[model samples]
Target: MDMSWPHQSQPLPRRRALAAATGLAAGILLPTRTSRAAASGPTQASALNAAASYANPVIWQDFADIDVIRVGTTYYASASTMHYSPGAPVLRSYDLVNWEIAGHSVPVLDFGAKYDLNGARGYVRGIWASSLAYRPSNRTFYWLGQIDFARTYVYTATAVEGPWNRLTTISTPYYDAGLLVDSDDTLYVAYGNTTISVAQLSPDGRSQVRTQQVFTAPPSVGTLEGSRFYKINGQYYIFLTRPANGQYILKSSGGPFGPYTMRQVLLDLRGPIPGGGVPHQGGLVQTPSGAWYYMAFVDAYPGGRMPVLAPVSWSPDGWPVVQLVNGTWGSSYPSPAVPVPPRPVTPMTGVDTFDGTTLKPRWEWNHNPDNTKWSVGNGLTLRTATVTNDLYWARDTLTHRVQGPTSTATVQLDHSAMRDGDRAGLALLRDSSAWIGLERDGGVTRVVMVDGLTMDGNWNTTGTGTEVASAPVSGGRVWLRATADIRPGAARPGTFSYSTDGTTFTRLGPVFSMGNDWRFFMGYRFALFNHATQALGGAVRITRFELSVP
Candidate 1:
């Protein structure tokens, strides 16, 4: 019962050790070499087109609190947002493996009403961990959300992608609420912490009909805020994460909300993971098949959280178990026979060199993007306007790299023709709280760290600044590398280095947090940006981009 415990440290990573265990029972870790296939000419375009063939988007960018629901053949996911856009990031996937940003739950929530006021303003008025619930009887969609941690409300939509009705405020102290519709067409809502509260929803799906009741887990188990409830084989399963003794599940045969018995932990902190345990956000469904699958995030510190998909198998006794043994979750499962074909085993993690005419879908901004700041041309050159400040750049920047417990990204840039306050570099940013970047100043490059946990201001210099190590920008190549060391419970380590040649690397600093801006649209992620006081007068040539989880 020690809730105030701290994170314990671990050893550093070795590439040879990882390669030796690639095909071991831990499931296949896609080889870092496969990344070459991603960068081949026109291959990115083909990949985007091929991604169109995928029906589910299991690997979405920055979509947190990942609650998924399936209707017919379509799967929908919703998450929290402080992004520039009006509402939280919502995506639609056909197969659960491929997803597209279909639209938002509230296309233009109250957050977008005042565009001029920025910097986590969208996060302040309320709205977090919004859940998507399907009303089968009416064939409509319902969205329930916690606003500003003080209010809860529900909105009805004809389609999951909607022109939603006005919000119907539901007074409740619960912060992250999960809504489920049962077999008899009964709608239920579950909410709250160490103990949970559940209540029945009115048939109309717009109101709460039953009184809220507090449910406690049997003393044998641990429980926390995120609770996902589902019914299978005539029994109700309440999936809760304690993060104390790893995450676990509780069960009962009662109604949607239950006097459930607590079950044992499904996945404990007993794997190859370097940091804390797998603290999941919400559960997901395997599309087209209606079979259940769990989509939870594993903390890859300093870099932020990475999504892990596992098959939830049922025991004869009706308890759910995660099949990921040791330290790996396979991309495919034999049981439950999902209908989709397996995607080629490719590196799910890597860096992107923007040479193509269009921006990759994987890139996202905090709020509405100022498209004028960026354009696809002789390499990706981002012009910094007067309105875009460091805080705004932190939010508006288009950044993404592969997400794994360990990986590295190196990008070459041309920043010699830059003006004052112009910064173009490699960044691993997650929230206003956790982020680190290598920025160029007056032709000099320095490593900067913004530790969100400390709520510190300005990107602290890690080491003395160094002059640009590469040749003067007349079409020369420069590289930045990010390396992550994940250990359970302790702060995840992220170290960045740079190179004139793409091969050799010099460490920038010690390993740091891989925090994603999702916690506030700034979850830990590897991204690229160019923000200048005037037009970035020089063409930035990124001749090569590479990422490997060695």
Candidate 2:
């Protein structure tokens, strides 16, 4: 018995409301951005219990423009990370509700020079709306996406935690393309905006065999994109998102590219978050026992777009539907079939002692990093990678996604070695960045909070950052913390605090407002940086970074 309903124009039932309210009590509705580990709904033990239900936006964090697939008993999802290096984040899960960082397809943003942050920036131009597919016969996974709308790049790996190799590039861009490795192993891609097209690829999925325009959406459906390909029960289905509000399906019964028929699959505004955007633009996956689910994202920025899972049912004629409760999308659902494998630990939150040879998959650089400038052994040491007046252009600035609704990130670093004109600290990085850290000048160190940095349409730093607060400090090691209030439609401020002695902390500067504009794309990220304003050679040793839900 699958308990599900289609969208109808009616109010939610009291019982559904009661269930959501109950979960909010346990999860506490979060606060703002943490790191990534802030769990929602319930504890993992209870969350994975056979009878326990899970909430929508199943795994909260900026896993936007996601495409998911199942391999054996495990599920993996890849999402957009515009401009952030080690792009195309891949998240893995067993139960779908418990997700963890599972490496990235692009170890570094190697598309061009700007991605290196050498002298220019690629803030809103990197891997996004990518396609992920697995060819079980070959024990390989394929990842493809268009960059800056110029051309599509292809990558392949034997394992999810990969040494992914860039296979080749297609001269023509397959915008928001969806890859389908058909039953015969022939490759096809369904892509484009408003006017949708399908292209067949060579055996290895590197070049195109042929391409054709398949279906063009009506003007009333809004702009269509985020096309995902699936062949269900013999029908070749192309699922697309109107992105701002709804989802639709194009079905071709005879061939991969054909005269197809389209239908409205989902058009609803109600979701888990109050005043949040509709669920749109994510992929679907199936369970071993044959249950189907649609994984979509709801726009809840400045926290960034987060993924949600919804049950799907097939119509007698074979169209797919997104389940609803009391005429609208439900906030929670009965747990999908639980996996037999052990649950994976959550990523990003808690203490990162920097005690390993490599940073966890959750960490990404502000752009392509200068590998020679950083090292990790006992503690993460960052050498000033560039000489710049602004942090935006500095190389090797590492960032982690800011957790949603509400969260906090704290850093403890040894700044004794910081040379003159060196600045090292923690920041909520966005178009309008704000941070608190140690700034060294003339061999003297002081804690400072800087904001008021301005950027133009081109993402250039039009105005230099201003120091809002400063304090002389006497310590070899200092702790800096940033708490963000990124709940959509709220105050959305990022606050800062500092502690010289590891025991106590005091507020440093006035709350700084974070941005929610789409041009900036990637949401507020917690950044750990050590950059030089005059010359290189200075460095900072970060011993601990603790992120938590407050």
Candidate 3:
């Protein structure tokens, strides 16, 4: 039963009304650091320094496949949120080093039954690479995204924090798509895998007028995707990322349709740096002062692919060159020169009380959530449902991006309502996942740590599961935690633990290794799920959730 509705004509306005109605009027403004960092522990303040220069991996969390655009003095970024409802997160920043979630382009991804968590499922597929473009011609913002196995869509919003208008779908599948509106008001889309492509959109912006292969990567360049297109100073620039190399820029002095020359503009092929990985897939942004910077991500595993900022300047040959220090990516640089008022620095991961009427913008559902199955009123109550035997197929799992190299997430669960055959706990979710939770079996409650592996990319139960540890428990309340140590050159295993008293924890399972599979496309995330293996099961209440870096 898909019960999702089309976004109302005026979503931002309606959202304001809903916020006021729900007593969230005070939270409508840009998030303040004092309020957001109150419960985030000591690491919150230490993450950023009060100096003119900032460190590399500007955003130390998994903000993968980043696409950025500058609007006057403000910088707006849109990133891929595959299968995470309230998809295509839009982040805003005054200084490039700091960012906060402003809003999402879509309230829900209800394109098909799978996206709605119905009989079918969309795991590694939903909204892939998205391109965010602002056209000064009509004062409109366009967001184009590729929905796997479905047609591409272009969403329009007058304001970035939008009541976006859902436009008609483009019948072509544009993988790693990028949207650009030329000064002449001609709409063009660039995308491809091994072969880079460019297409002209119809005047109405609803269909493609013509498509062509602009450039193809040679066999030497392995795994090329994530195309970000731009037309700057009368030159058409297309950026592509290859795991074998770093990021390359293709420049065409001709037009949107091009006879382009390619150059390796940004490369960190020397492998992982102290706080960053190889620089890859991202967009170029310019400040009001006319300074240019490249925002990209590195494959950081358990923490996923995190964003990094690098300074950019053009060479004598008219090619953009990334400013690397001493033949390597710099660890820190002077912050972007932008004049703005003092704003709070917010951490990517924080503490949740589950007392508000709405979940924080940082939290997202694994899939389009069943609104009727969860609530934040009396703590976060997650009602169990028998969707499938495989946890990846389970719906309504709440998740947050896992923070870098080292971080720990803890959740206090009240399982008084859990029925027999129900499993409820905290998990590190990806193609391969593991959880430490309370399972109800034959009227006996036990604390169990289970590891599940998906053999192929499919969402079938053919995958194997191993019970690492189990112990009988008598209480209706339990505290569970998982710690990840994924620092480059360090042992990469996620350890799970449980506690009867919130003060002290007992190690539960064998250390589980974190994995990276291209099929998933994103890094591992911390997730909360409650599901039944057999029949309709019980509910679990998450009283408190906290994430911290050790």
Candidate 4:
């Protein structure tokens, strides 16, 4: 299977038409991420630290299904979280080059039992491509997305640092939608697959007023979705993604829904990551100086899709053009020139001490957790929630985005409290996963490394696969390390090791090959899991957690 897009030529992105964080302990800054550009790549690509320019995959991590909005000088972006609790992450940026966690739109995925991973049933389902909009008239932010393609969930808050409220659930499904709060305070949504449609929402945006199909793609542009709506200077534009790879724009001067005109904006665009695909789907934002920039994501799996920014230039006739160098999207560009640039933000990568009452915004539960089973003070504790051999069904498996091109994650676990048949440790999680952890059986505890556990279409998985490596561990204190090379060019290793004294470490088990199939949209992640295959009541305490991207 070819994960890297190799057939990108012209008529790329629609030129051929047709379709298409926060909180907790002191900061532990990540070492500068490695940046390697093509030999003939831009001169500044290697100077990622320069203040004047920034590299593509601007913020490298799993910030998939993105929609970015700028409020005054501050830029706020939203991304999809399928099963992770505290879904719809809100990211804040000052200079567009740097971003930090602001908050989340949904405190928990409460629409149904599936979202709670009940029975491990919600595997690859929950929130999909969401549309985020802000209503300046009310100083409120709105987020809309469909769940399981069954119903659209709407949430709203006065600020991005939110105590967001679930406004309503629409029976209407807005698949991969874009939300627009017109100047008159009226709401409009553009959504659908190859055939895009616009719908008018009640002023409160709690209910749909009406719906209309505006445009349908030609047969050539296959699989079009991901709608990002905006009303620019009285013209409405919907930016969409056309895969295997491309981004197209639909413009209408008439109204929110119109007989729209189409153009291709991005196609087969490549970034610094050698095999990474082009950037697309993100909306456009303009700086105070009237400079336009497009923020989009490139498919850099097994680490997941990442956001990239490129400049936008309006053509002589009012069409928007994606700025490119050497006939393709380059690896570096001049950063968005914002007026009164906000102060630099601390990067999201770091060490976390779970001393605070609230989990840092960056940490998300694998699903809507059984909140009663977890707590944080000096150490993060996870009580066994399910007596299942499958970690997929276990609630409260905390997850963090794995950094790219390469990064290492380490966690200290105190397993003294673990009951028999409990597994607790760090993992590189996806549909197929591998983990190094402590497993207790009949009172004997052993550090084990397991791999090749995968789920079927129904989300069933092998409960406790045979361990590849195991060692009897006497002490209750253990440290697990996971290092993954998610460099985008080809498959790489996601290796695991264990430490007893926090100083010396020994690699264990065969290296797990990271999978890069794009169909699993969430990509690979670093997960902290504790689940039971026997009786409940077993638990583990995470004393220290650090993710180093260097």
> Which candidate tops lDDT?
2
Rate residue 194 of model 2 by lDDT.
92
Q: Taking the tens digit of each residue's C-alpha lDDT, what string does model 4 give over 396-420?
A: 8999998878889999999999998
Clash count per candidate: 52, 7, 0, 5
Indicate the residue-level lDDT of 224 in model 4: 81
Error of 4 at 252 (Å): 1.1
How high is the lDDT of residue 449 in model 4?
Answer: 94
Tens-digit per-residue lDDT, 330-385, candidate 2? 78766665444453345556788888789988899988999999999778999999
lDDT digits (tens) for residues 1-550 of candidate 3:
3334323221122112112122211211111212111223232222222234556667767677899987755678998888888899888775787777777887789788988778787776787778998887788888998787468888889886777878768888888988888868898999989799999998778899999999988776666788999877678989898863488888999988899888887555533346336878899876554556888877766567778787777765566777665456655655555554245434566788888798877888988888888999668999985445677767889988877667899999999899888878998888778889987878899999998655465755456467779987777899999998766544678989988889899999898888765567777888999988877758999999998876
Per lDDT, what order, best first? 2, 4, 3, 1
lDDT of 4: 0.79
Instruction: Sort all candidates by TM-score, best to worst.
Output: 2, 4, 3, 1
TM-score, prediction 4 = 0.89
Best by TM-score: 2
Cα shift from native, residue 540, model 2 (Å) = 0.4
Q: What tens-digit string does per-residue lDDT give for candidate 1 at 271-315?
A: 323443353676745433223567766554444444455555545
Better of 3 and 4 by lDDT: 4
What are the Cα lDDT values of the candidates?
Answer: 0.52, 0.81, 0.75, 0.79
Model 1 poorest 10 in a row by lDDT: 7-16
